[model samples]
Target: MNEHLKVLCSLTPCFYIKREDQASIIGGVIEFIKELQQFVQSLESKKQRKSLSPSPGPSPRAPFQLSTPQTENPKELGARCNSPFADVEAKLSGSNVILTTISRRIPAQIVKIINVLEKLSFEILHLNITSMEDTVLYSFVIKIGLECQLSVEELALEAQQSFCSDAVYVNDI
Candidate 1:
């Protein structure tokens, strides 16, 4: 039984790769982690959605407006790099809580946000920042895991707290 189990494990692709390229196996392991994380997240979201009956809240609409700032207090700082397109949005996909924002104020608000998320242990899946409507917009699609139960309130508060400096103005999405 032990030998059979060992043979089966060796036949698995990731295990084979692990045996072959232990050092460069980091990328494969990272991808495995991501897939596992996503699967767990989907299960969690399904459970959460099932536990509570759907509130008569609005149906999931296109470009669903998840949260917006209560106040718009713009702070001005001198000579920053502006990307000419900035808009931030976040969503809960399966178990992944994706947060994204955009800003045209130079040095790129998205770049600053990436730093903050890194500090907070959030894994970013995809990010797209480009110039639009004469304003720099940042859109981030993140994966929130069990470690980070990123609620809308917490995300909004974090956005307000971290990016509220004179460098980036957290706008309503």
Candidate 2:
């Protein structure tokens, strides 16, 4: 019995069967293989559909417009005028920071920001940028290594002073 058990363990086939129950085990193994094949085929079809889908591009619709209030408030007007360079917000989770920036779509702004993060010795885990008309939004997930010495507030302040002076607000999540 011990030798038989060893032989069964060494078998590389999907299903092992005792000599007394070969028929039932074989049937079960066949059913499992069939289901696995079907699952693989479904996954292949999903991949094909995703590959055929259209890539994201700028919208064909008209540019966004903010409605102006009829009442004359200088504060309101100023806020509206400066809406293009809004703010930067960062949220820290574990060693990862989620940074969001909304500002005017200056060319190479994304590249410049990435360079700053790399200079600070932070690893960028993910980055996404979206643009609508003149406005651009950036979302970045960055890993602050154990060697990083700067606190979250310091990092945010440095980012604002160095590259995003136009940002009117900066906050952590």
Candidate 3:
């Protein structure tokens, strides 16, 4: 099996990706990961619709909103990064950026997240990773390139999109 596929399997013990399903994409494994993420989301939304209410052309309800689960209280410097799916943040100080993410320790999840940083043309000056039983914490200090255009909010969105798994909250789908 491909390395990323192996990683995907590790993250998602429920879904099994067949070797034959490893089709071609422009960016190889990273693009494949994005595709799989979207596929997973699509399935979850369909499942949500089915479960929420049956009489649906489209439910008038608003889409779900998510917030970081952290408390407003202060935490010690090295405290654990805790979040069920992912909590992504980016802070830009001049040309340097501090990026942090807490995500489930599933297969290609980390790779996908790091790719988001690299894709933004940043030099990873410092990277610290901590893995607990089921969650992983990532902290990075990166210097942004001259050509980088994304603001801190955009960076957070990219990282969140990259690693956050939507199906995690659901028991089985």
Candidate 4:
């Protein structure tokens, strides 16, 4: 029995059977395989969890921070035009205008801004948008026809007037 156990232990194909006890060999192999399977399953589960999770931190696309004073309500700013804290910039070169805005995240805000631009007869050339938890940033390049009379400053003022939030910042580049 001892010699047989040694032969079984020495078997190259069954390297897992390190013990010399014949009765416990199968049980040990079964236990080892089960442990291996469990470890693999845990690894797979971790991968799946990571893939399914939403971003744990700020998105890479977020461009800037939207900081508002704690004492002021964003909604109040939204009700009025030309917030003192609002920052706006507009650049016009020939018939092209470049505008960028950062503001608190408001639902349908982009649609409203697009509507304003269209009303002013600006043709959208390029648009880029990104959002963090509570803020949104937009960059737009637009072409105004020769017939359109709105200047870059006028357009920037209009956006500030429409958004009515101190958090809104519009700039041209």
Candidate 5:
């Protein structure tokens, strides 16, 4: 055998890592792996839950794109209105409706949105606002009254008209 091999074979126990330290490190790694596995499982379960959700309402369309109106009423600005929002979407969640509006930070526009909601007989349950760089997101959880007969299309058209009427310049929304 080589001289280095002989020395390694006969080295004192302290020359190598302690078994306890090795076990501790291995245990920590195992624990981290287990935690990572649990996190993945949680994400998968969330996807499963989303897939199993109920069929959508009568007027479900693409989230970002508005559906074409069956009839063209002179009063309604279905898709012609120039909106400032990067995205405007609404969905029914449980007993409330969630309206998500993404736009550049326009403080006055928020008040207009709130007024629109109040005018529609929607009770605002919660509002979540998030700002990122130049854009801001507004999420409103609104409860529709049982007596209300307005459809999703009506709500959208009314909101759009409100903006269109208020806008004096071409750049306004």
Candidate 6:
């Protein structure tokens, strides 16, 4: 019996060394006792667990390395069309639209503005508010539904009327 096996047997009562009658007879009782004693002494060291299965091989393909380019659109020069809302930039992209307005009083006007857009059947996706020295403006990136058919100019005018004044001014933007 291996020394590690002997210790494992003593610690765990489930294991036992079977006595072979012919081998025990040849060794004699005293020799058999000495062999068992040697086995117990060898078991003082710990037994290492062995794995039954072999390790897996490395993968064939290399991992993906994503390289994103760092670039920016060229900044355009020239005085932007000047108006009281000169900072506003509105654009329609597919089903989505972005409306940016620069104003001094937008914070106090957001709720009314959104209500007007809702009335016009525009569905807002996101709204961002920004400010400068007592004036706050908002940018809304909206998803206009498939059923929407109003012109951007008309919508802008409606928004102006909804937030800027009580009087609805048609045919003007």
- Summarize candidate 3's per-residue lDDT along 1-173 as a digit string, tens digits: 57765565555322123232555322245433543453355446545755886563333222323333232324311122222245565655335776767555768776777777788887787776766565566767788888898766667767776654434322343
TM-score of decoy 2: 0.45
Model 3 TM? 0.48
Alpha carbon lDDT of each predicted model: 0.45, 0.52, 0.55, 0.53, 0.53, 0.47
lDDT of 2 by residue, 66-128 (tens): 323232324322111112233454556445775656655667778778877888888998776
Give the per-residue lDDT of model 4 (tens digit) for 1-173: 67755654554224344454666676555534543453345345444644776866323232322232121223322111223222344554334665656555667778877888888888888776655555555657688765679755577767665555323333421
In model 2, how many backbone clashes occur?
Answer: 0
Against the true structure, whose lDDT is highest? Answer: 3
Query: For residue 85, what is the lDDT in candidate 1?
Result: 30
Q: Estimated TM-score per prediction?
A: 0.41, 0.45, 0.48, 0.45, 0.48, 0.44
Cα lDDT tens digits for candidate 5, 120-154 = 88988878676656556566768988776776656
Candidate 1 lDDT score relative to the true structure: 0.45
Ranking by lDDT: 3, 4, 5, 2, 6, 1
lDDT for 76 (candidate 5): 29
RMSD for each model, in Å, please? 15.8, 19.8, 15.6, 25.3, 21.1, 34.8
Encode model 6's per-residue lDDT on 115-156: one tens digit a residue.
Answer: 877887888887866554544556677778677776665555
| TM-score of candidate 1 to 2 decimals | 0.41
Better of 1 and 3 by TM-score: 3
Per residue, candidate 1 scores C-alpha lDDT tens digits across 128-167 of 5545343344545566655775555556445544444543
- List candidate 4 segments past 4 Å from native: 1-86, 165-173
Residue 40 miss distance in model 5 (angstroms): 22
